[model samples]
Target: MPPSHTPVQYTTRIHDYPLHYTEAGSGEILLLIHGSLCDYRYWRWQIPALSQHYRVVAPSLRGFWPAALRSADDSFSIAQHIRDMSAFARRLGEGRPVHVLGHSRGAQIALELACGAPQEVRSLILADPGFRIAGEAPGAPLHTTVAKLLERGEVEPALAEFVDAVNGAGTWRQMVSWFKTMVTDNAYTLLSQIREINLDVDLDRARRLQCPVLLVGGAHSPARYGSRLDRLEQAVGQARRITIPAASHGMNLANPKAFNQGVLNFLAGLRADEARPPAGIP
Candidate 1:
């Protein structure tokens, strides 16, 4: 049987956006945010694992399913996403600093939170973030990207491709619903909106981060746009990068073992440091 999952529930409106959240486990807080074309469930693996040592809160971003915001801007712009995510963190974190892990586009959001609220963020883990290429801009609309996602093939094949990646991870059955998200709000429409927008990471702003940051990625992934670990490290003064050789963009599913272990190891270092801070800092 799968391990029992106990979810702590909470709902709060962040700037008129009804933020639907799921809290599980207990201890220091770790906020998990998802990238575009997905919701909070993307971190299903992290919560149960990290929950053993920390309180985990994963929330659906502003316009995702369940608590869809009004027909507001649907483009998954980094700044807008950052704003929404930051508001949710502040309202939920209750003024206490917390660690954060964001995957793909969510990684950019995590960086924005750290950049905007450094003191409120203790540490950050950006996994395969699209930090923009040498000659790219940020904040594109979603419709364009959705178009691209579908243009590659019909929805069925796109989903089949994704399902194929997570086949052995035990979540293949769930892919049916997971795949439905593509057509949500007109899949291509949303993708086109998101793609047209300048959806890139802001490294110039990242230079201000004062906390420990880790950039994780895999050896195999479409891996276009930005999202380079080395660039992430350079952007943030106190940052490092880790690459999972046998993994792909779908690290959580394609390579759960290494993905989980890599995350645990990084968090463990933070745990040790938190336990023993620099002299006179307490």
Candidate 2:
């Protein structure tokens, strides 16, 4: 098994909301953004390995576990998350650009950050980015069904359906107890997520990103994610794609060794490129 270490916890105020996060190791900052039904804990398998080279900071988005919603009026949309994270990055990096790695829904927010606030991001890594691309056919209303189940208080069933919908059939059953607990903790967020509009990304927006991008995918993941990555690769000028074998939606957790190595190699190459002298330099 890969090395695992407990990360130090901290809370910071962003836009008047207290955001909770975990930090480990030290170096260039690497902000981790998790997807649906997840929080900072989702990066448990990542912090230990990646932290050796970079300061890994994983924040639980507002409304997720450990971050209570202030009131029923508190917002929970992608735009709000993007704003929170942009501010969070600025505060954490202290005016320096930080490396960013986001998974699933978090990947969409990371992309938006890279596009909207280019100066704050040095490079971007997206794993199975979960967003509808403009012109793609509408997917089934899985979120709607999950929301209904939550409304009925069938939280487990609702999460199971969603886990299977994205990761593949029987994924929920195979999930470890800890993972299940994490999912259950953030179940209510699905209700708010389903209500959000404009979750789709367009090629023009993807084209606006100015940093290097690494797209990671699970070899066994559903075709939809692969298709989205395809479109993104075509749009982004400096994008690279890789797939982890024997994994699905949760590739990092499923195959951490390969996932970690791939990410580190990408970051290392970026450093090497930076070290190389400009062309025609003596």
Candidate 3:
């Protein structure tokens, strides 16, 4: 069994919202971000492994499980989450550049923060995140959609459908396994926006990355995904991509060994690259 993860909790205010985060180990800062419907618990594997050589900071994203809800405007917009994360980095990064890892929706948020504050971020690992169209009907708000789903018991099914590759039957079954009851309870309560409330990032702006980057995904991910990471590699100009063969959409949970090793290997190479002297220097 993997050693238990004992995280030290820290509560701080970012803008007007209260931020709840966990910290452990001591070295260069390594920030971890979780996707929608998940709290920091999602990074349990990487947190302990990475912490051995880096200071780990995992925050419960606002509008997600362990964080406070600030707006009825589907509080989990990419912009607000990015802003909040940037604020957290500004306040907690403590003058040292930090490395960041984000999964799913969290990956989108991390991308925005790194773009907006390049100096604060030394490297980034973005896992399996892409665009999502969440709204329909101009006048019908996203929260209204959530309410309708609540009435029709469609929420879990909808969420489960998201991981069809993992769930053999389809959405409802997948949702039951992915969201679970407790996670669903929290998810249904936080109203969402008709569309992503913040930044709109897809393959378009991937070329703008200013730091070392690692694009991560599952080797067995659904074939429908068109290798966005491959596109990112071309655009980023200095980024690398790695897929975990033993994993699926959710690599961290499904194949922790491969995920941890992939991350550690990449981080080690990054540190080595930085430590190496200018090529051609005597």
Candidate 4:
């Protein structure tokens, strides 16, 4: 049997809201941020695997489950998430920088954090980020379709449609009841996201990131997603790219082995570089 995915749960007040997170292992901090409609549970497969070599901290973003907001407000914006994550990371690090990993919408927040506070983040791993690049918007027809379904009081089908769009056909049905419940609990946040505008990161700011970056995507994902990764790679000079074969937008959930190995290998290489003496120093 695979190692248990349970993590030690904790909560800390970040700004105006309480952020719930799951932590495991001990070493340099590795903060994992989940995407929209997802909480800390999304990293179930990764937590146990990566915790062996690093302190893995996966936090449920503001307005996500276990603390879902009753009112929809600006508090759920990407800007707000960045602030919360920055505070969360700082608290975890105790003055040291952390390795940040984000998926989908969470990736956008991670980018903002790296750009706004380079000192707080040691590195970045963005998987199937859902955002704009170089003034181009990535199409999300499923978002609209799901919104319509939800408006008609069809929550289950809406959730199923959204999952299938990101993962693959019939993927939603395979998910456990707990996962579906969490998604349904946080489904309201999707409306806020759809109405928001001018949320995409500025490449000009992204170009200023000095930390090592590893861009991850699924080989079977839509072309727009791949293009966004390409643009992001160009913005963060020297950034590495890794594509998990036979996977879609939900690479972390669908192909956790490749996703985990890719991240672990990148981190190991970073550690190696840090230990190596500068050329000509000897």
Better of 3 and 4 by lDDT: 4
For model 3, residues 1-282, the per-residue Cα lDDT tens digits are 134534566788888887888877888888999876677666767777777888889998777656534334555577888889988887777776788898877888888778888888889998886433222112214345554555576766444543453323443453434347435645543356435533246544556777899989887665422255655667688888888886666778778888888888989998898899998987
RMSD (Å) of each candidate, 1 decimal: 5.1, 1.9, 4.4, 2.2
- Candidate 4 lDDT: 0.84
* lDDT head-to-head 1 vs 2, winner: 2
Stretches off by above 4 angstroms in model 1 are: 1-9, 68-76, 133-145, 148-192, 223-227, 277-282
Total clashing pairs for each candidate: 31, 0, 4, 0
Error of 2 at 270 (Å): 0.5
Candidate 4 per-residue lDDT, tens place, 1-282, comes to 133545567988999677888888899999999998999888888998999999999999988887775445676788789999998888888899999999988999998899889999999999988777657854556667777777787888988888887676888888877678779898877766765433566789888889999999999987778888988887789699999987888887778899899999999999999999999998
The predicted structure with the larger TM-score, 3 or 4, is 4
In model 3, where do residues sit more than 4 Å from their true spots? 1-7, 67-74, 132-147, 151-155, 163-182, 197-199, 202-204, 224-226
Error of 2 at 281 (Å): 1.6
lDDT of 2 by residue, 108-209 (tens): 999999989999999999999898888888789898898888888888999999999999999999999889998988888888887653368878977988
**TM-score of every prediction relative to native:** 0.77, 0.96, 0.82, 0.92
Task: Sort the predicted structures by lDDT, highest score first.
Answer: 2, 4, 3, 1
Ranking by TM-score: 2, 4, 3, 1
Tell me the tens digit of each residue's lDDT in model 1 across 50-126: 77777888887766756443233545456667788777777667898888988876777898889888877878988
Q: List the residue pairs that clash in candidate 4.
A: none
On a 0 to 1 TM-score scale, where does candidate 1 land against the true structure? Answer: 0.77
